[model samples]
Target: MHERVATTPSLMIKRRLNATPAEVFEAWTDAKLLMQWFGPENVVTQEVSVDAQVGGGFRVVMRENTGERHEVRGTYSEVVANEKLVFSWSWITTPERVSRVSVTFKPDGAAGTILTLLHEQLFDEQAVKGHTHGWTGSLAKLEALFA
Candidate 1:
C-alpha cells in the first residue's frame, strides 16, 4: 500500500491594499496584472496565465537574478468575483507535493481593501517558512503597485 503523506501547516497573510476590492481581485486573477507582481524581490515573473474560473487552471514561471527558475501551476477550485479564490498549488519539480491557496478580498471603506491569503497543505514546517518569506517579499511588490 502507498503511504499517505499528511498535509498540515499553513501560511497566512493579511494586508490592507490601497486599491478597491475589484482592482485587487483583478490584480490576482488577471495574467497581465499578476505578472507585474508575482514573485519575490529578487525574482522576476517570466510567464503567467490565469484562467480565473472554477475548474480553470493557472501557471507561473519566475526567474531569479542568479538564473534560477521556478514554475508552479494549479487548478482553481473556487472563484468568487472580487471576494474569494481557492486553488490548488504545486511546483513543477514536485507535483506530488500539492497544496492549496485561498485569497479573500474584503471592503474596508476608507482603507480600500483588506486582502487575506491563506496557503495550506504545506509539506512541512520548512515549506511553511519558505513560503512565508516568498509571499512576504512578493506582497511587498504587490503593495507598492498601488502605493
Candidate 2:
C-alpha cells in the first residue's frame, strides 16, 4: 500500500500605498478598480465581477499577451470595511486546489496605508512561489494607481 503525503505552503506580502485605508479597500472591493490592477503586469484583465460582502463571490478573467486566458473565482469569507478581507480562492481550471487569502489594511500615519496579504493552504511549494510572484507584480500595479 502507498501512503500519500500532502504539503501546504503559504506566502505573505506587505505593501505601502500612498492612499488611505478606505481607498485601498475600495480598490479591492470595486470591480472596476480591481480589474485595473488585479493581474500580473503582462496580463490584461478581460472581465471582472465582484459582490463585495461576506459570503459574496468574485470572478476575474485575464488574458495573457499570448492570448491565453486564465480565470479565477472566489467567495468572500469575511469582510470588514477599510480593515480586512478574507476569501477563498481557486482557479476555475483547478478548483480542487483551493486556497485562502486574507488582506489587512491599516493607516500608515496620515498619508498612506499599510497593506498586508497572506495567502495560505496552497497545494505545494510551487504554488507558493507562483502566487508570490503574481502578487508582487499585481501589487506594483496597485501602487501605480496611487502614484
**Span of 10 residues, lowest total lDDT, candidate 1:** 3-12
Candidate 2 Cα errors over 4 Å, as ranges: 1-7
The alpha-carbon deviation from the true structure for residue 101 of candidate 2, after best TM-score superposition, in angstroms, is 0.1
lDDT of 1 by residue, 8-100 (tens): 998899999999999999999989999999988899999999999999999999999999999999999999999999999999999999999
- Model 1: per-residue Cα lDDT at residue 21: 90
State TM-scores per candidate: 0.94, 0.94
Residue 44 of model 2 has an lDDT of 97
Clashing pairs in 1: none
Clash total of candidate 2: 0
TM-score of 1: 0.94
